[model samples]
Target: MPLPNTSIAHALDLADARHWTRQPPKRPATRLRHLLRQTTPSALALRLFAYPHTLTRWAEGDLDGLTPAQATLIEREIYRTWQPEVRRRAHQQILDHGGCVTAQLHARFAYTTRSGEFHDPRLLNVIEDLPALHARHLFDARHRDAADDELRRILADGIGEAYFFCALPPDQQQAALTISDLHLIHFHY
Candidate 1:
C-alpha cells in the first residue's frame, strides 16, 4: 500500500472527529515517539503494508522521524486495531516473570499436545507463534552481519557478555567460549 498522504491539521481533525480525547496536536513529537515506541520495524511493515526494507531503513537510523499526524494515524488505525488476545499475549510475554509459568499455563488453557497432535487455538490466532518469531530473529542474526553487530553492541553496552553468553544456544555458547579464549590468549600473552 502507498503511504498515506496526511497533513498535520488533517490528522488532528481525523483524531478529533474520531473522538480521540488526547490533546496530541499541541505536543506532536510526543505522540510520534509514542507510536514509534509501540512499533518495531517488522511490526510496522505488517501494519503499514509496506516492505520491510522501508521500515528497516527507519530502524537503522537512516530515515528522519515520522510526522506526528502519520504516527497518530498508525497508532490508532494499525496498532490499536490489533486483536485484544494478541495484545494480551504480547503483554504477558513481557510482564510474566518466568517463561516456564506462562508456557505451562498457555499449554493448559489454550493448547493440547500429543505425539504429532499438538492443538492450539492460539495457532489460529495472530501473534501466537512466538517460538517462530524467536527462531526468525535467530536466523536473521545468523545471516546478517548488521544484526550480529547490533547483538554484540547490545551485549557490550546493555546486557553484558555473561548475560549474552547465557542467552545464546548451546552451540553458539561453545563458539563464543572458543572465540573468547582465543582473544584472551592473543591479548594477554
Candidate 2:
C-alpha cells in the first residue's frame, strides 16, 4: 500500500492565503479602523484574504476612541487573564459594594487540550497565546523551540493560520483540527 501523491506539509496552504499573508500588499489607509465595527469576526477572517491591514487597529487593541462594538469585538477576540464581561461586572459591583471577585493570573493563554484518544474534539484550556503570554509555561521556553515557534508563525499576522496549518507537526495539526469552532484554525486544504 502506497501513500497518496500529496504531502501533509503541503495540505492547506491556499494560494490566495499564502499570497495575502506572505506578501501583504502595501495599500494606503483611509478610515480602515471604521471597518472593524462594521465587520463580523467570520467576515473579517475572509476579508483578511485581500486586506489584512484593515484589521490592524482592532488586532492591536487600540480601541481608545472606537465604538463599543469595536471594543467588544476586541474583548471577544483576545484572551486576557479573564473574560472582559466578567471583569467589568465585578468592577461595577466593587464600585457599589467595595468588594469584588479576585483573581491571580501568573499567566493567561489561548490553549486547548483533549482526551488521549486521537479523535477527541473537546478543547481543554491549557496553554497558548505565545506573544500575549510570553510563551509562559506549556511552551518549551528553553531551546530547540520547534513547536512553540511553529505555533507563533501560524499566529504571526493572523492571516497565516490557514496557510500554515499543514506545516505544523502531526500532533499539532491534529490539535488544531478541534479549534475551528474558535475560528482560530480552519482546514481549507
Candidate 3:
C-alpha cells in the first residue's frame, strides 16, 4: 500500500528523540507511575500521533463491518485511553533508555475507506472520559465484533476528522486527504 499520507504523521528520529529523554526508570512499577504526570503530556500527545495504538491495530485487522466515521470516534477514545501508556513509555524510551527508538508512528494511517467525508480525528478527551469509556466498553463489547473494534468507531474510522486531525499535521508535511478504495482506514506505523 501507499505510505501513510504524511499529514497525520510525526517522525522523531534517534536524533530528535535524544534531546527528549530523562534518566531511565529504575523499575517497571515506577515507570508506570510517570504517565500523565504533566511534564510528559504535551510531548507524549505529540508522540501519540506516531505510535501505533489499539486503533492502529484494528485498522490492520479485518474491517469488513466498519466505517471511517465509526473508526473516527473509536480512535479518539482509544487514543485518549492510551495517554497514560504513552507517557510512561515515553519516559522509558526518552528518559530511561536514551530515546533509542528508531522512530515513532504517532497516528500515521496507511489505509482508510474511500467513502465518507473525513471525520475530525482531534482528541476531545474532556479529560475525565477514561472511566466512562471503561464502563461503556463492557456494554459495547456485547453488541458486535467491532464491539471491541474501536472506541473511535463504536468509537478511531471512528478517529479521523484530518481534518483525521492526526492524519493532518499542522506542518502540511504532506496532504492529509488520502482517499482510498478500501473501507477501513489504516495509519502508518
Candidate 4:
C-alpha cells in the first residue's frame, strides 16, 4: 500500500533494516524461558510501536541485549500483523483530516483499545466522545482549578467570544494556556 505518512514510513523502514541482521544468543532455550517469564501480552502490545525490539527479544527467547537492528526487525513484524485494508483506511482518514491533533488522538485511542473485535459499535461511541475528553485533558493539564466556579465561568464566557485568548483576564489567560516548558520548546519551533 502507499505510505500513510512520511515520518511513520521512514521509521518503519529503519526498523526493518535493523531487524534483518540480528544474531540470536547461543543458549536459546534458557533465553526464551527468561523472556517468557517477563512478558505479558498487554505489555507487549502497548510497547509494540515504541519498543519493538524488546518484544522481539521476548519472542525469540533472546537473552542478549537488544540491538538497534533487532528493534527494526521487531517493528516490521508488528506491521506485518496489521490488517492491510484496516491500516490503509486508517491512514487515509488521518490524511483526509490533514493529520491534526484530534486525528492523531483518535488513531491512538483506536490502537490502544483494539481487541479481537472489528468496528465494534461501542468503539464508535468512544471515538465520538474523544474531542470533549481531549479538551478536558488539555484543560486539566493547563489549570489545577477545574473545580473552581470562577474558572468555569471564565472558560464558558471566553471560549464563545471572538479573540478568546485575548478576552481572558491576565490571570485566567495564564491559568488556561500555561503550557509546560517542553511544549514551549515544541511550539517555539
Candidate models: Cα lDDT each: 0.33, 0.32, 0.32, 0.33
Ranked by TM-score, the better of candidates 2 and 3 is 3
Give the Å error, residue 49, model 1: 2.6
Models 1 onward score TM values of: 0.21, 0.17, 0.21, 0.20
| Model 2 per-residue lDDT tens digits across residues 1-189 | 422212111122221132231222122122233344555545654624433454564345543445545433343222221133443443344334533211111111233335443333554322222222222221222122234235333333232233324366767654332222231222220
- lDDT, candidate 1, 1-189, per-residue tens: 534422222222232233332333223334334445666656656755655565555444454655554544555543243243443444345324433101100111111112232223331111111233332332234234233344332222221223324465665433221111001000000
- Model 4: residues >4 Å from true position, as ranges? 1-8, 11-60, 76-81, 92-189
Worst 10 residues of 2 by lDDT: 7-16
| Per-residue accuracy of model 3 over 1-189 as CA lDDT, tens digit each | 434422211111112233333443333223223433433434533533423343233334534444444444343323333343443454344433332222212332333333434544542322111222322332243223232234233222222331234545456433333322222222211
96 in model 2: Cα distance from truth in Å? 42
Model 4, C-alpha of 131: deviation from truth (Å): 25
